[model samples]
Target: MAVEFASPPGNAHEIALTGFQNLARFTQRSHREGEYGMQALPETDVTLSAPRPVHHLGLLQIVAHESIRNSAATGWQYLVLTEDGAVASSELSIGTDERPPVLEQVNMGPFVQSTASALEGLDDIPDVQSGRYELHTLKIPALGAFLLWLRQLDGNADLFIVLSPAPNFLQAGRIYREDELLDALEGPARKRLEFDDSPRGRTEK
Candidate 1:
């Protein structure tokens, strides 16, 4: 099955590219040999090339073990492909009337590799070819969870695959429906949110 991605806002790519270029320049200057006071700085030459937007990162707030809230779109995640076939990732904040999109962070973590792997194996997943799916990322900060959200475009049969460094009880590379994933995370969310039966702490299921 081919994976599709949602379109990001207009000019987002240009904005992200500009910010990335600025970072690259700074890294080059700072990492150059014999630069005064730069000896102590770690060598961080930003060699990422061909920045491409991959997925729309959506934020999810876990209000309780049985409840979750979908927050506004966080931004777009771009994958940087280098000549060596290595993959890196960067985040750009969504632009608003008050400010333009800005590079949020750059990372060389499991996220990049995991996402690539997921996309590659997407077709092998059972029942994936039945419907069109748009790739997105779901981040649950409180639970330290990040997942590749394959949202079915014309149906309710969405799927989620937990990324590496998977949180407790959630296995990486496993496909889960919304309810199944939520059920598995119930214990963790309850512990994290300190949910109780008391009205003050009770979470609406």
Candidate 2:
């Protein structure tokens, strides 16, 4: 069974694509000029999946297990499809009242690779095979955690796949339901919050 992905909101693709095109042009020129350490560009194209909205959570929000739906959309991420698969990713900042969307940066990290791997395995999950999912990126900076948030369109339980460089308590590449993920994050979130609230932490800030 194949996994069904949700369509992005209005004009998101257009906005992201425009940003990507601009980046690609700059990258090409930079590569030719031997600038910014661009050894070579990847020979790949964009995936069929639309840009996924990226959401962020602070320590307080993570500790509270706040619903991501309440979080504002911070940015949009597009996966680059290599011959091997979706191995690279790029991001675009959300448009504001004062400005339009802008290209942020491109990433070819463990999180990107892990997200691609998780998506490849989604077809094996019965629940995912049965329902449509909207892919979203969730980042918890305090925990150094990144997750592929598969929000079930039918209002069922959502799936959160942990990416690499996660906190010790959370296992990378593991697919966790909302409750499970929150439960796993509880201890780590508390520890982090406690540290951040401490005098030493305050002084560092």
Candidate 3:
């Protein structure tokens, strides 16, 4: 059975489970209680391999931030390191309302994927963590900036962490209707669109 360990949107998943011995730079987890009576800090990291080796993929850019917020911030974080083990902060957050990143800047790959194929990687089979914790390596080149964005970001009724990927032109053209990808880009694009219009958030000091 092949188990899949997908990171939650904008959340950090730990790698303390069994079978996940390949982890290089993993974040520790506290047994405190918060979300679900147990939540890990939003800052915790679950690096399976600091610089993914087998795959020259980058920081493991997440396709979802909300999941990051929920799963990562409350419990132990679990993430499979890329082959080289290099994961950046930019691979996480959507960046502050400030110089939010472009799709290409934050996405990882040339691996070429349709929304479906990419998503198919997230299947929940049986006990497959190499007899320990199941692990999957992700690639996010811009992860550093994303983390910086999270740290610098603040002030809101409830700041939301939304994982919005740019238009995978090839995938979008084939998988989704034109409008769907347009919609995905709308929020971030609109936020970016406002860059020229208004000003908010902090500058990197």
Candidate 4:
């Protein structure tokens, strides 16, 4: 299923605060194979939530496995949403055993660290230029959500990653240009998959 980005009318801080509040409601999976891969191994159950089955299992599996390396047990998985409240794409964060630790290690590179730093709540989100992409980080300091937007110089699809604070490190990322980085600041909330205790079976919403 695509992630839902619609939020109750409000400013960027309000929207982000609301999204983080919702994140607390998600059920936690103890098994590696449970819902959204929180169990022995992350697996997808067609009968659960999510509007459709995951089409990119290989990539997601890699991400799920990799996530463990960071000791990242708390996660908020969801679809990347646009400023206007639409699913931009599906994103995954696997648990991995490798580590001193890394952020977004599933897709490692300058983008990962740069984006994470921007959202770490140190100062304000900084604008970073990496190769052809100009990344602008938007953070609602009062709230837990931070959005990282990477616009390309060639007018191609831009990259966006929305993040919330850790413990429950939920993220939604995708490549699209329908929504401007600033517009997303106005509001942001996306739908996520829900899982049961059984690792092999999960329900998506």
TM-score of each: 0.74, 0.78, 0.20, 0.22
lDDT of 4 by residue, 1-205 (tens): 1122222112322233234223323323333225553212112210111111111111222223322122223222223222432222222222345322111212222333434443333222232232354433333332344455444445555555554332133334432232343233322222111222335445221
TM-score of predicted structure 2? 0.78
**Candidate with the greatest TM-score versus the true structure:** 2
How much lDDT does candidate 2 score? 0.71
- Worst 10-residue lDDT window for candidate 2 reads 39-48
Better of 1 and 3 by lDDT: 1
- lDDT string, candidate 3, 30-55, tens digits: 33322232222233333432211111
Give lDDT tens digits, candidate 2, residues 1-205: 3545555656666665565555567777888887876434443365535367888766666677887666567787887775667645777776666465566777766776777777778778787778777788888777888898888888868888888777788998888998788788778888876777455544321
C-alpha RMSD of each candidate structure in angstroms = 5.8, 4.0, 16.9, 19.1
Name the 10 consecutive residues with the lowest summed lDDT in model 3: 144-153
CA lDDT scores, all candidates in order? 0.63, 0.71, 0.26, 0.30
Spell out the clash pairs found in candidate 1.
none
